[model samples]
Target: MNNKTAIVTGASAGIGKATAIYLHKQGYKVFAGARRIDHMQDLVQQGIEAHALDVTSPESNQAFVDFVLANSNSIDVIVNSAGFSMQGALEDVAPKDAKSQFDVNVFGLMNITQLVLPTMRAQHSGKIVNISSIGGQMYSPLAGWHYASKHALEAVSDTLRMEVKRFGIDVIIIEPSGTKTEWAGIAMKTLLEQTPKDSAYRDIVEAYADGSFDGFSDTPEQIGELIYKAINAPKPKTRYQPSFSAKMMVIAARKLSYKAFDRRLFKQFRAMISK
Candidate 1:
């Protein structure tokens, strides 16, 4: 790992932060990117380089790539982890809200990946790790728009992996279950505001919001560890399902017919709300 240079987006907190610190400890030249530079002060003190990056902006993405390439000559790994969730039914979600989710989770990730690809290709070797969610594969009754964005990401990552393999650049996807992050709290708040009682999906929104308020999310570090393995493994798998529940959920979704899956999901939603 010491022989490589890694650029981790969203490195200020949660899984991104954990992965950055872990890479640095393993002797890699780690560049941590996030909007809040202060959150990465601790990393700088430990010899990791921190950069302010807003992945939604093309200028910011290009600038980050330029800075890293100029300083290090090459980047061996890139982790795209700058994303958030906004929960609500599709009808309850405003167009602006849905667009905003895609702007950050999908477009922003693509911007950075494209910016870094030229350099990676020049080096003839690189790895791109995209942090998707279990929500990407299976729909969440509450987070419809957010799930749409992740589902789009799944397609993007799949296509990119195939497209870049010939370049010796491996693209890996990390699918995490409900990990414990500030994301859920923020998502729940948005759900309430965006899907008020007057909305058609109010009942489902309320049910999901209540469930999110209760404790059901996993820690971000679990995803971080899975990400670390994806980066360092000699022959990394194309897709990694990090959380145990996340894995099971994907399996269950796949095993069940669409009607059965919908029935089970709705039942789970009712159970959550009753509690």
Candidate 2:
């Protein structure tokens, strides 16, 4: 991977930040992209090229792509890690909020991938790693919109992998369980914002939010290492369910029917509320 150029969105913090640092350590010329460029100043100090990218904005995405193409001539890897959760019941989430979630998680990811594909195809070798969530495969009632976005991403990534194989470009999905990042804190805040004190789902939402905040979430570095492995591997897999529980949950969801899965999910939610 040495001397290769990589563009990692959401590189200001959390998994994106860790991944950028990890890639840099592995000798890749990393282009760390985030909305808050100042937040990535540390990455610049560490020799990673930092770019301002608001994935939700088409102009920003295009500008970043143009910048990369002008400077590096080719992008070896593109990691779409720019996304967030807007947690709440489906009925409670505002339409605008739901659309915004899809704008970032789905449209933004797709835009960046489309921009990078031409270069990857020309090179005949490149990797695209999309950071999705375990919630994509196994839904949590508390994070309805977030789960829906990830599910969409899961499908898109799967489809892209098959379509891009002929071009020698690989599309890999990274499904992480609850990782120790600001993601849960932000999700909890969104949950409280959408759920009023008297709402029917308030207690359940609070319980799930609290549990997520207190859970043994995996470290961002763990995900970073997994991403690094995917980038370096001779033949990367289609999907990497990283965390222990994440992999197990996907397995369980696959084995169980819909009714069984719903029952188990409800039981788990009820137990959390009871605690």
Candidate 3:
């Protein structure tokens, strides 16, 4: 055993679960937490510690952190992956729901990070990997709130990276595209739920729902591998786009003018609905 400790949130399923397993295989003492404790039985059987965690709940976050600290001497890594995508036209999505998106993706993540920073600062070494999305770099229809949250996360990660460097803590962002997981289904559900049947944007929203954006979908394991690479690297890049399409989208967003990107995006949306 490496005896190095790692904390993984949202470990009941999807990329978070896969990441916890990968870290375990890499010999880190992994403590995995999620709201669904039953879903983590397999992790426990694999010698990983599993606990119930709701990132939005401060008490739960505190308890999870304490649990890990009581068992391990040091926190070497923390992969904050407990987030979901909410999709709908900005006007159509309920304001409260939009706030919930930010709560989980931005504020909740910061809450957990604040809890771990003291330990990392004292140890003078740690890795903070945030699982963002390609949407963080580019925008799309029916997902304004979700994209905004990711954009916020990206900006926060960048600022935190500079702030924590003095204490030897590295904040890294991972931008993944269409990773095969339950996230897509949940996002689609939100798209439909947020937009009414008689809504003017219904046609375009339905078109987006019917389409398959996962033609080149990556597996959760693949993303887990990328997370491992970032954590293990001596000097990892601040941002990582795990897939070719993600990298291209980020580059396009950076190189193209806002109006140009909008024209291209709308053109694609037009095509999607026409078919």
lDDT of 2 at 160: 90
lDDT of 2 by residue, 1-275 (tens): 46699999999999999999998898888888999899999999999889999998889999999988888977999989999778888878889999988999999999988999999999999999999988888776867888899999999998998898999999989998878887778778878877888888888888877885666568888899999899779988888987778889999888999999999988988899899
Q: Which window of ten consecutive residues has the lowest lDDT sum in model 2? A: 208-217
Candidate 1 clash pair list: 180-218
The TM-score values for the models, in the order shown, are 0.94, 0.97, 0.98
Predicted model with the maximum lDDT: 3
TM-score, cand. 2 vs. native = 0.97
Give the clashing pairs for model 3: none
Tens digit of per-residue lDDT, candidate 1, span 57-129: 9999989888888889789999898996777777667788789889999999999999999889988999999
Error of 3 at 75 (Å): 0.3
User: After TM-score superposition, what is the CA distance of residue 229 in candidate 3 from its true location, in Å?
Assistant: 0.8
Error of 2 at 217 (Å): 3.7
* Order of models, best TM-score first: 3, 2, 1
Give candidate 2 regions above 4 Å deviation. Answer: none
Q: How do the residues 103-130 of candidate 3 rate in per-residue lDDT, one tens digit apiece?
A: 9999999999999999999999999999
